[model samples]
Target: MASKKKKAPPPSPQSLGLPTGGVETHAHLDMEPLDAEVGAVLDRAVAAGVSRVGQVFLGPAAYKDGKAKFADRDDVFFILGIHPHDAESANGVNLDAIAQAFHADPLIKALGEIGLDFFRDWSPFEAQRIAFREQLSLARELDVPVVIHSRDAAEETLRTLDDMGFADRPVLWHCFGGDANLANEIVARGWLVSIPGTVTFPKNEAMRRAVAAMPLGAMVLETDCPFLTPIPYRGKTNEPAYLAFTAAEVAHIRDIEPAEVWHATARNAAGFFGLTLPSHT
Candidate 1:
């Protein structure tokens, strides 16, 4: 008998109907040796329809090739800030320098990935608080939105914002992992909740519920790439192109078509970052 030919495995259902003009809101393209050669990386991203990527530029050590990587590229905009871990390192001169940079660079759209991470406690609570508040002040001073990262310190983080009145800017709880109640409160306050690949894991029930119940306008999509790879690509190094995976998963959870999720999320990112999204092909 002739041997039967092997059948090709079906493509991931999650990969279907990917929208063009997709934007990745929280890609850390400035993270280390990877930052070097990000031009080729971004070239690939553009070819894949990810035309815009918001890069969060960190310290001199992190951006050592003299002025953060991709600084001149128009396709890559940035949110300038000192991360919470760098709290102590952000001394007087450095703080003034970054503020001056932001004043000069209009492309620096937001202040972010800047908040508390009690999980790591890389910086002391007091120092993190001071740095966080100062950046929030700078963001508000500049009329730009702020991106926040909270870990086990959510309550304190929120409280600090409340006290500092830093909650006024268009704040996004990036890669939000808070519970439903907290999510609801955040949405109620008109803040955006960004969902990353963690929402796709079977065990991440709370996150799934949060996304399912979140209002369409209050949601934004992100890959948090080089981390949080979605379903089929989970555990792999992610890229901006993989945002389609996340948008599809969010659509599935919300029982809507992927395009619906794509448009709304794109609109949210554009509105939040003040980016003008290019038309999809």
Candidate 2:
């Protein structure tokens, strides 16, 4: 009988050896197998050099129930908004709750992952549009930064942002999986883009090119976990710890030191959300 070959060790974010102070700008830890191990997950994040995480609550209801999970965590901030999938039932009541929550919680940094998502179409397009506009209006009125989620609806999303007078305002394009052209447009609008783990995928040459061409100051890194895990750990459940892989990959694409991407993206994220994160000497 032929001898079986030894199994390769699973990849880890530690291999990237990124310095501390990385930020995970997007994550859904309220859901999963992830929630079950969230404590251990966060410890690993710090160990892997990620010091901050933005916990995105899909809507008011989710925020109400999930915000407490990170109550004791100063390193974790909050982002609450109605996602396109939940737009059908979007109403003033929900918006009121979000507004109240934002006002009551000093940690609620931005109003997002809002915007269009024609790809999912889980809710009616008209409903999604209405909810998006409503939330944008609220963000504007409250004078908070906005984090947008546009998918297969970039054109309309841009048009809507322009219509809403978002140009030159503080806004972040979350989970940016676009080509160079789109990246340029976003930069032109004075919006920063959060590059996700998708940039590390072998087939996502467009995202890699986009990261290369983007102004490093306008780019941040995110895991967008429980999903979009980077290569070498692509199929595993993503967490804040995986953010280092994303930073390393961005540095590889840009031909710079991983620490450069790590520090710059962390700074970008902190400034965008007005966060005062811990510093590593």
Candidate 3:
């Protein structure tokens, strides 16, 4: 019988040279098997230098679930909104629920993971548009920043934001996979773009180029965890601890030191999310 192939060991945060107290700007700890191990997962993240996590609540249910799970954790902030894939289910009742939760929880920092997704079209296009518009209005009313999720609908997304007149508000393009031109446009518009684990993939040259062209000031780092796990750990479930790999890749692409990428992204995340960094960071 042939011997089984040995799995490569996972990278350590310290070995990767990540800076202390780096923030994970996007993750879904409220979802799946990871949710059951939230405490341990968070402890591991801290051990890996990811001291702050922006736990994204995709819908009203996720908002409630995340609130129950992390209400007392000061290091875990919340971003609550309706994902484009679930636009069909969004309505007055749930929208109200999200708004109420936002108002009730001071930890809720932004209104999103919200925008257009033409690729999946999991929800009707019209419904996604309507939901996106309404949520942009809500973000304006609440005076909070917005996190946008535009996949294969970047043009439409930008047009809608311009039309809705909320383009002036702070916007964060989460898991940005667009080209360098789009990245430049986002930076020109004064919006932030989050670099995800996809940047570590070999075939993601476009994303790499985008990261190269984007100014450090307009960038943030995220795992989009339990999803876009970086290379060397691609087959494994992603967690905040693996964020250093993404940061390392970003540093390599930008031709800068890993610590510079980590610290700059952390600062950008803090400013965008209104998070107060620990004194040491």
Q: Give the candidate number with the greatest lDDT.
A: 2
Tens digit per residue, CA lDDT, model 1, 118-192: 889679989988888887777777777888988888888888778877554589998888778889878876789
* Regions of model 2 farther than 4 Å from truth: none
- Per-prediction TM-score: 0.88, 0.98, 0.95
Question: What would the per-residue lDDT of candidate 2 be over residues 102-190, giving only the tens digit for each residue?
Answer: 99998899999899999986889999999999999999999999999999999999999999999999999999999999999999999
Candidate with maximal TM-score: 2
Clashes of 2: 0
Model 1 scores a C-alpha lDDT of 0.77
Q: Alpha carbon lDDT of residue 65, candidate 1?
A: 40
lDDT of each: 0.77, 0.90, 0.87
Q: Residue 60: error of model 1 in Å? A: 5.8
| Whole-structure CA lDDT of model 2 | 0.90
Give the count of colliding residue pairs in each prediction: 0, 0, 0
Collision pairs in model 3: none
